[model samples]
Target: MSALPTTATHEPEAPIISAVKSNASAENRVHGLKLAILLGSLTLVTFLSLLDTSIIGTAIPHITSEFHSLPDVGWYVGAYTLGAATLQPLSGKLYAYFPTKAVFMGFVFFFELGSLICGVAQSSTMLIIGRAVAGMGVSGIFNGAITVLSAAVGNEKSPLYFGIVLGTSQMGIVCGPLIGGALTEHASWRWCFYLNLPAGGLAVLILAFIHFPELAQKKTFSMALVRKVVPELDLIGFLLFVPPSVMFLLALQFGSGNTHAWNSATVVGLLVGSGVLAVIFILWERRMGDRAMLPGSLVKQRMVWVSCTYGMCNGCCMMIASNWMPTFFQAVKGEGPTLSGVHILPSILSQLSAVIVSGALISKLGYYLPWALGGGIIMAIGNGLVSTFTATTSVGQWIGYQIVVGAGRGAGLQAPLVAVQNAVKPSQVPIATAFLVFLQNFGVSIGIVLSNVAFTQTLTQAIPLYAPSVSSQAALDAGAGAGAVRDLVRGHEDELSGVLRAYSEGLRNIFYFLVGMSCIAVVLSLGMGWVDVRKKKDSTKSTGDNEAQEKKVEEKSLNEA
Candidate 1:
């Protein structure tokens, strides 16, 4: 009656969190103080990297003031996403094939470099470039954090650890707006980026003292090794992947409703070129087979597809809302950047709480599907409710809507990763993790561009009806920041209210799209299948039998001695 295969994917092994690894003895494990520092540093790295993504959200108004470009909002906001998405597969493979600690530290160097660049950047384009570099490092760090954490605490307990780490680091991401706002208002917008340098530097310093799982089996990076490493990293495959990806995302950024007409040469040409490149990539990957950056066999798995889709949908809903919510507070509510960031805290805190609780529930119950399924339904309701928000929306209504939306997003954020990790072999886990991360970034990138498209398209029509004296372009320009909006309608109260309502309508359309994506996520989540993580590897060892395990370990250690 069920499609579940009993013997293939689910290989039996004794649960090993409290037991010796099947590969190495108990002595190889790092515990106590050193372990705490390792995990804390890893979480810190993650926090700083993710903080960059949102820290700029509230600071954007300040940023736009200096740059004077509003249409490039997607460029500034998603530049890091572009880098994160592009480097994902390679980042995963690097962790898989190289020494983990060394590669992680290397990524930290590059991430810090990007932060330094952003702090000193003079133009919007330069800032976007810096963000892209930082994003590249974030990609490796994300994959490495998961891989390294799993090795530290066996796969059996990884879900809980991941929850702890993600829950902790996510604080940086959601709170970035608050921190960025304060810094932007009091100090300078550059402080938002400058903040990462010292914090990330300290995290790297702590990491240098620790040992990693991959280091125990280190290989010299000789010329012969380079020959193997090049192919292993799938340099050619990524070369093909990068161009088409950039083309596709750029097309979305300039999509008809946002910048150019559907029939315009620029949009049409980019779409066609991107499609052709994508086809070539698929064909080349097919030829490369297992050696490809995206292996066909792994990519073809039902669970893998479902997980990637689910991750994409979850990211799409969450990221688009995050980007727009701050704008709502500033534009319609006429709040300062600091107050806007404060108002957005409900969503952030609720999302974090949901992730921590949901992760614990999944670990205890050994089921991720129910959370994924339920989260979608709740998220759909949340997004739909949020879509109803308007200029006159009350404080209670906004906060309540955000909490609901955040709960739904946080509940399902990592379900796909948990599901994929369970479905694949340990060796293939890095690849799967990379794939999931890629799709999540991809979804986020496209969602952000499209949200802008939806917002801009609605504003174009609404501005004419709402404020007859104001040109559509001028009103659109006014939305570059709240200051601009106030300046544009300073003389007329009626025009001000009209512009505010236009903003509400424009943001509403974005939520409508999110509602549809949430429903699709619900459908995709259903196909992740059902597997009890505990039963899959429950064998001779069980944490429930702790006394027996201690005695067995003691005897084994004595025998070796």
Candidate 2:
């Protein structure tokens, strides 16, 4: 027998996505222009936030130049990603407990504030701080976008609408480097951040006008309400989660080339502390039971953990590759930032195309497992091909290889998400999504750090071997930016080719890691039980249906218990 559950098992009694169909009549639904405006605003915000993540990759070289601080580049990216990962799951509970519109708008305000801070940052430390704040907002926005979108359109059409949101948002990510390159070259690196201020403000303004149905709450604020809300947010779990994540990322950032040696006291202490914190967090969550950030019952499910692992590996493979390609083009081929961004269009376009096509196929065939498996296999092959790139690799080869990688990533990017939605009970869907998103972002943080470690370690070793006159420490001091790489080797014409070759080899080394990660993703994906999303049925009265589903789930839970 297949591992896939043919019927509902023990799940939650109440759905996280409100059964608005039963609560609100058809006549009261937002449609036409109002609906368009709401969705458009949400989609725009999503695009801008995701765009910020990739846009900085191209701008980093310029930013490093302005501040003359090459050592902080990893922190710049990792700070935002870490912040987002930390807050992602918590945001789900916030939405569940508060007025949806208000909570979402509040996050937008903070996101914009962070963007403004980044736009005017005068130092690298200030910029890193700004990125962290902005990431906090992004985490909430991501969770809210899907939650509100589902509630706005109802369950029947959410899949299609979600596809649109994801496609549009990813378009921002694809176009980020292009826009960042243009702004950084023609204007200033600061403009890359300044652009978000106006755009984010506009999104906030539009969101302010739209009123989403509010969950019932206390009419007046009181200590009692605060007491009730604090525990629901799982503040203790939040505290426990932070130390390990912070320690782990700090160890990665500081251990290799950034500041400290791997065996240095700081690095060793952080790694050991992180391990201890992780154990404590797991034990804490187990004690918290259902109130935990990672609820024990839901997390123990085979499908949930499998999907989460796939998401983590998928994140590691795709993000590490996408963020580093511009540097590859700039360093190896000596392409200008704008042209390098343009060259990456093949990967971006293919990824976008695959996502849309795969989404439609999932909707039509109702099966995501085949696409997930195929995507993982294709991605592994793509990354493997990319790992063969050399200093003199032909343009056609690079482009073709990237296309394969992009297509593969796009095909499976959202497959795990789709599987989670289908496998979990309606009530558990939101948390499950949040958990996956957290894992994905957390994976992204680790991937970028891992890439940094590999790049710095390999480049440090290869530089001196290939170009004996140039000190490896000097190149290490140049930081992870392409511009810095060129500047460090500028006067030594005889050593330039050797240095470029070293950079190329170092990059290829990172791809080798990505290839392995992609393969691991494929293995994890195999455990996602087969379920046909297309053949799924939606009952007219979800509230009544929910009750029946609950009874079935209860029996299963009891039997297992």
> Per-residue lDDT of 471-525 in model 2, one digit per residue for the tens?
8778766644566767776777778888988888888888989988888888888
Clash count (model 1, backbone only): 0
The superposed Cα distance between candidate 2 and the true structure at residue 45, in angstroms, equals: 1.2
Error of 2 at 108 (Å): 0.9
What TM-score do all the candidates reach, one by one?
0.87, 0.89
The segments of candidate 2 whose C-alpha lies over 4 angstroms from its true place after superposition are: 1-23, 68-71, 215-222, 480-483, 538-561
**Candidate 1 local Cα displacement, residue 382, angstroms:** 0.9
Q: What lDDT score belongs to each candidate, Candidate 1 first?
A: 0.80, 0.80
Tell me the tens digit of each residue's lDDT in model 1 across 455-556. 877887898899777777776555546787777676776688888888889889999999999999999999998978878657425655787879999999
